[model samples]
Target: MNFSSKLLENAVAEFARLPGVGQKTALRLVLHLLNQNKQEVEQFSHAITKLRNEIQFCTRCHNISDTSICEICSSHKRDASVICVVEDTRDVMAIENTSQFNGLYHVLGGLISPMDGIGPSDLQVDSLVERLKDGEVREVIFALSATMEGDTTIFYLHKKLKHFNINISTIARGIAFGGELEYVDEITLGRSIVTRVPYENSLTK
Candidate 1:
């Protein structure tokens, strides 16, 4: 089979490196981009470069932002006493789109998965504990996934914050098993927030 230029192959390989994008899709995308005008391609390249160079994670919430703190953390209209803990910035965006939660958020960056070599210490858990130390927070809502790794992270966080006076809760099981927050619809996400329940240990009773 006749092969394309090395430049086209390189672009396809780079696109394939993105999450969930396979080689075929990557090749198709590269071909589409190659068909575009030079000016358009230049604009696309510039935009992607700017995204990497200009964006930064918020120091407070760990969400991707242009500044040190994300807009949600810096906004005065949000409820400072309530904090929702999410697995990543995507979950934060999902919850924000629902418009059901008005509180701030703490992004763990990932769940506790021993198989993946990601533990509590690897996440932003210590920052969460530090934030709770002030005693200003009234409630903490966990918006993590329903997977075992997510459950383990939740329990670890609960144990760590048990001594605190704040109420700890988890979003309702409206999210289906193995469902990712990024794929859940806004209605289900909003309902989950509205029907959140307190975390409790049945064995302790």
Candidate 2:
């Protein structure tokens, strides 16, 4: 952890602060960047600066964007009436990569975790309720992860949206297509069987 130069030490410290990055990894990254041409390093620094300074969040879904409204929200081809409720913009990106969902998204900003001091009020819950009250979205699909926090958030949202006319749904949680039944967890295998779809319905998709 001892760097010959204070500048290198500072850079390594900053890099180490990033998630999943250890001190050794940070030191390696800093060394790698140090070996790069001055112009390339300047460009790298400028790009980071630009991302922090110029990034905007979508007014509708709270997704990261370069404008007030994200491209997906503004797209005419997407189904605005069906909103996919997710934990954050990363979920949006993951779903978008699938090319399977053609619906709009509602980023909750973060999940409800009382232990972490994050409550429903800390998220975009009010805005989502308002969106539902506006009577535009007909179907709301919950696409949260299968964790305790994710489940808690979904339950809270379900209660808040129970009276709404929108059709409530959740992304199917089960074993992967190629996964073996023996290797799958008991809860997942049980849920998969309980939510098993008709063979004909599965074939169509």
Candidate 3:
């Protein structure tokens, strides 16, 4: 698509680069921002810049944070004995929104998708193993999406952690196969977490 102004074209291009954003939507967003006051636009730009520059990943869980460790990881109130393993920060947000889980999280960053050239080494799997070595965590909950890639990731992790004498479980199949946790209804996701099944049982199906 052609724009009369090069500035408008550039803004639209940048917006379109984001996932799920099309050229038309990008154009609309750029036009909307053009209608806003200069100060408001500057504020928007500054906010994005500040977020990119200041955001830090939690050293322990790999979740996005303002500090080296996230509030959830550092919280004394959270159950340190249980760790819910998820694919990314978005899944963390989804689970947190349900308020059903009081335990901490381990964000793997991404799953084991060999077709996409993502393997165990591509994830934070080694860090998770290190976390389990001390016998502090009693349970590891696989709260990843109910997809094939999710299953592959879970299986690989279970194999790595099996020797630790810790309980290993996965969120109930209340979530549809291929359904992302972030998109599942909160009620279903909450129920799944509350009624999880053993990792061994997950292998049967």
RMSD (Å) per prediction: 7.6, 1.1, 6.9
Give the winner by TM-score: 2
The lDDT of model 3 is: 0.93
Predictions in order: lDDT: 0.90, 0.93, 0.93
> How would you encode candidate 1's per-residue C-alpha lDDT over 1-205 as one tens digit per residue?
2346888778888999999999899988988998999999999999999999888999988998898988999999999999999999899989999888999999999999999999888999999999999989999999999789989999999999989999999986777767999999898899778876565721224
Q: State the lDDT at 173 in candidate 3.
A: 65
Order the candidates by TM-score, highest first. Answer: 2, 3, 1
- Regions of candidate 1 where Cα sits further than 4 Å from its true position: 174-205
Which of candidates 1 and 3 is the stronger one according to lDDT? 3
Model 3 pairs in collision: none
Candidate 3 segments whose C-alpha is farther than 4 A from its true place = 175-205
Per-candidate clashes, comma-separated = 0, 0, 0
Better of 1 and 3 by TM-score: 3
How far out, in Å, is residue 117 in model 3? 1.6
lDDT of 2 by residue, 157-181 (tens): 9999999998999998989988988
lDDT (10s digit) by residue, model 3, range 1-205? 7688898889899999999999999999988998999999999999999999888999999999999999999999999999999999999999999888999999999999999999999999999999999989999999998788998999999999999999999876688768998998997889788888788976633
